[model samples]
Target chain A: DTAVSQTPKYLVTQMGNDKSIKCEQNLGHDTMYWYKQDSKKFLKIMFSYNNKELIINETVPNRFSPKSPDKAHLNLHINSLELGDSAVYFCASSEVRGGAKDRGSEQYFGPGTRLTVT
Target chain B: DQQVKQNSPSLSVQEGRISILNCDYTNSMFDYFLWYKKYPAEGPTFLISISSIKDKNEDGRFTVFLNKSAKHLSLHIVPSQPGDSAVYFCAASDLGNYGQNFVFGPGTRLSVLP
Candidate 1:
């Protein structure tokens, strides 16, 4: 079974269009995160949700919004997508909010969604 | 500023040889360090990790070493295989921040040749 999964493995859209990427985790984790990997392969956290509560919001553009309907799902919605937004977006999940002594805090990653904004 | 850095952009090693990837961090509050492996079109997978209090942690063929005083860490793979070719990422987190803020290095690509 897939521990973590994201919809739209590949996305191509025009600039100024709105798009959404959905993610789900079956690991029963309490925290889920959204990360963007640029062409340079630099992975940076964009948003983090713990038990459906927004926790970490990086300096991402206001056009980017993340909504968590439950502990198992976190969806990212981007408005007015820009060409600079062309990159891979990843969804991750962990068991706890804080550092777990056993490193069970390790984030389980999805296969990643490659978004291309024209 | 980039808090975590992997100075070497790429490294090549022969199969059956040892592979060592180095990483450095400037944030003193980072209490946990981890190494991840990634292939093209896939997200990173956790490999190993070491706590600030411990200098070394080993798991089978992979070993992670942390030098708290030097603010450095390294991942060593024994008997490297061709399948080991992938990008490696070094990440650090401050436990005080609930581990929410993890800074990752740009990454180091390892090419293991037969």
Candidate 2:
């Protein structure tokens, strides 16, 4: 059983195009996150949502927006996609203990969505 | 600045040998650390983790050691098998910093050859 899943494993689009990637987690986790892995293979967090509430926004570009319709789903939408946005986007989820967000909780990740903006 | 760093890009080890992967961090506030392993076309999965209070945590053949003073940690896999080959990522998190938590390092690919 897949704990977390993302659609469109491979995405190829031209510059200035708008696209969206869908992610869903079945692990019943309260926190969901969006991460972008650049060509340098550096994975950085873009957004995090806890129980349908935005908790972390990592200063990502304004064009990139993350929407969490529910606790189990977090979707990423990019407008006017630029060549620099070509990279693998990962979706992850975790259950954070209340009043102890500092503790490390194992994050379950989905098979990344590879976006290529030509 | 990059808080977590895995200097080694890749490492190779023979079957039944020991494979050690090292990670360093610059952030002194980071109190929690984790190790994740990923295979091709797959997402990273949690392997092990250690807190600042403990120096070592072991699970089966995998062990993680943390040195808080040096701000360094290492993952050791004893009797590594061919299936153990994967990309290993080191991640660190700071207390009370929810937005900046979960800083990850560029992963190091490990190849366990038979």
Candidate 3:
């Protein structure tokens, strides 16, 4: 069974177009995250949600928004997509077991979504 | 600024040999370090991690070494097989941040020749 999964594995759209990517996890985890991997293979965290609450919002542009309808799903919506928006997006989940300040927060990742904005 | 860095961009090793990947971080606040392996067209998978309090941690053929004084960490894979060839990423997180707010380093691609 796939622990984490993403929809629309590949997205290609023209400039100024809007797009969205969906992510889901079945690992019974409490926290979910969205990350962007640039052309240079530098992976950075963009957003993080715990139990449907926004916890970490990075210095990302306002064009990108993330919505978590439930604990198991976090979807990303990009507005007015530009050339720089072209990159791979990844979803990950980690459990907060036995409290202890969320120690050993090992994350499980889903297959990435490759986005291309012309 | 890049808090985490992996100086090596790529490395090649023969099968059954040991592969070492290095990573450094400028943030002294970082207490947790992790290594991830990624294959083409897939997201990264967690391999091993070590905390600042410990100098080394081992699991099977994978081991992580942490040097808090230098703020450096390394991942060693013994008897590397072709299947182990992939892009390895080093990530760090501080206790003050929310759970696992990892700062990732630019990845290093490894090629294991059989």
Best by TM-score: 1
- Candidate 2 lDDT, tens digit per residue, A1-118? 8899999899999999999999999999999999999889898999999989988998899999999999999999999999999999999998875335336577899999999999
Chain B of candidate 1 achieves a TM-score of 0.98
RMSD of each: 1.3, 1.5, 1.5
Model 3 misplaced regions, further than 4 Å: A97-102
Ranking by DockQ: 1, 2, 3
> How accurate locally is residue A77 in candidate 3, as Cα lDDT from 0 to 100?
95
Each model's DockQ?
0.59, 0.56, 0.55
lDDT of 3 at A75: 99
TM-score of each: 0.97, 0.96, 0.96
Off by over 4 Å in 2: A98-103, B98-100
* Candidate 1 CAPRI-style tier: medium
User: What alpha-carbon RMSD in Å does predicted model 2 have with respect to the real structure?
Assistant: 1.5
Model 3 lDDT tens row, A1-118 = 9999999999999999989999999988999999999998899999999999998999999999999999999999999999999999999998764224235677889999999988
Evaluated at residue B11, the lDDT of candidate 3 is 99
Candidate 2 is graded, for docking, as: medium
